[model samples]
Target: MASRARGLNEDGGFVKWDWNKNKYIWVSKDEINKPSKPGHSKYAWKDGNKVAARRPSFKVPVKKACRQPLQVANKHGKMKTPSPKKPSRRPVHHKADFIVPGYDHGYDDGYDEVDEKENYPRNEKYNAREGKIPPPPELHSGHTTILSVMSNRLIHVNAALTFWRQGPNEYISYVIRTEDDAATVDTLPALVNCFKNKTPVSKQLSLGACFELLPTLKKLLSSKFEDYVKTSLDTLRTMLRFWWNDLIAHRNQSFSGDLQQSRSVAGIYMSAIAMTDIITKLCKRKDGIAKKAEIVGTLLAQL
Candidate 1:
């Protein structure tokens, strides 16, 4: 029979197993006399309680192996097509309309001989009926014989002083006159008049008397004699100047009067006026030696 009161150290409180009586005994050092037999029940012997067995060792499940994220290729849109270029059109060439006959390429081959032969007789007939003289080959076409005459007159007047011839038995005579009358009367006429009159005492004197008196007079005049001659000549020139002015005034008035009545008269008057004015100006200088002589003598006499 198992003793109910028997204790095992592993149990919480006093408890016993019926088959293990000797293991359940409460042994003490003071009770050595009540010792159990050796090897009688070895399994039944108890000193201290055994610890509870630990739970079995186990491995935790490993995390599922992660897969790497997949890489996707990028998509591109379609490429654009290039437009085609157009070609340029060229300009058309044009041919000339009126083609002249008898023109040999670029050369003149005397092919117009027939035309000339047909026209020549008609031209001659027309010209003959008009009574026009054929021009002389040697003559100048633009200038007339009148121009030649005018040019020759200019040359003659330029040489008039030295080369002019006097009538036989003519003598040098001095005449004094006012400026207004000089233009209409010729110098030769006045000079002839002075000789005929025999008015100047100097002219009538004998050669001996002239010789005797001239030296003394010349001495008194000295260089001034030249001035005296010039003074007398100035008086003559004044006459010429007034004459020219009158002539020009007359021509201009005549031309203007004739302009409405007759163009030919007006043209003739204008031409004549132009010719005279040009000739007068050419022969007479504004500051002439004669004028200077007159001025000098007057100034000296005043001094």
Candidate 2:
């Protein structure tokens, strides 16, 4: 028979834990080796004083994993399946100005998603629904010119600043007449107004406001200060175009790589905006070509 009770002591004696004494006590090895009583032998055991064979057990069944599909919210707050198709290079017809993913040149430019959505063109039909005049025919077409793209981008930036209520107060006085005027400008039509014969409200525009209205500011300042205005405008446009191309290149190079590059792109974009303001001030002072050249050099070096 096998010993099934207690453990062997250092002295080679059988011992078991004593709850009352709080220590191990000696036990009789012969008594522990005795067979269990016949009445308690219900479970089959191979030898006396051995634990009965373990009862067979069945495992609980596992259920298969279930996953839900992804969904996106439309402008109307309705949930719909995300479209796999890329946004058309042309204008999209929609009831509201909705921000569609994969629209900004189909690559991340390091600007936050908010900036991407804010920079998009205003939906033409959405404007008409609000009882406002639609923009020019060319602006609504599939193929938009580089000048138009730049102008539209500036307008949208102003509109975004207006939406966030961070735009210069001078903008309100210049654009707003009655209290009922629309909060945001109709972009394309507003761009057209920049080239019109009417003078921009120079007195109403501040440095910060001038940065927001680049195309119109060129018109405004060129009228009063012609010396550096034209050259500065050309330089600024070239700088913006180069910066945009650089962003596209960086996006291609580092799409799946380091995020630090993305952050740098965002910083450069903001720096360009700051440079625009600096150039505006320079134009206001009629700063000579030498100073403009130096500033342009510095701006290019940072890129």
Which 10 consecutive residues of model 2 have the lowest summed lDDT? Answer: 66-75
* Residue 90 C-alpha lDDT in model 2: 65
Question: At residue 121, what lDDT does model 1 achieve?
Answer: 62
User: How many angstroms is residue 263 displaced in model 1 relative to the true structure, after the best TM-score fit?
Assistant: 47
lDDT of each: 0.35, 0.45
TM-score of each: 0.15, 0.18
Residue 119 of model 1 has an lDDT of 54
RMSD (Cα, Å) of model 1: 38.3
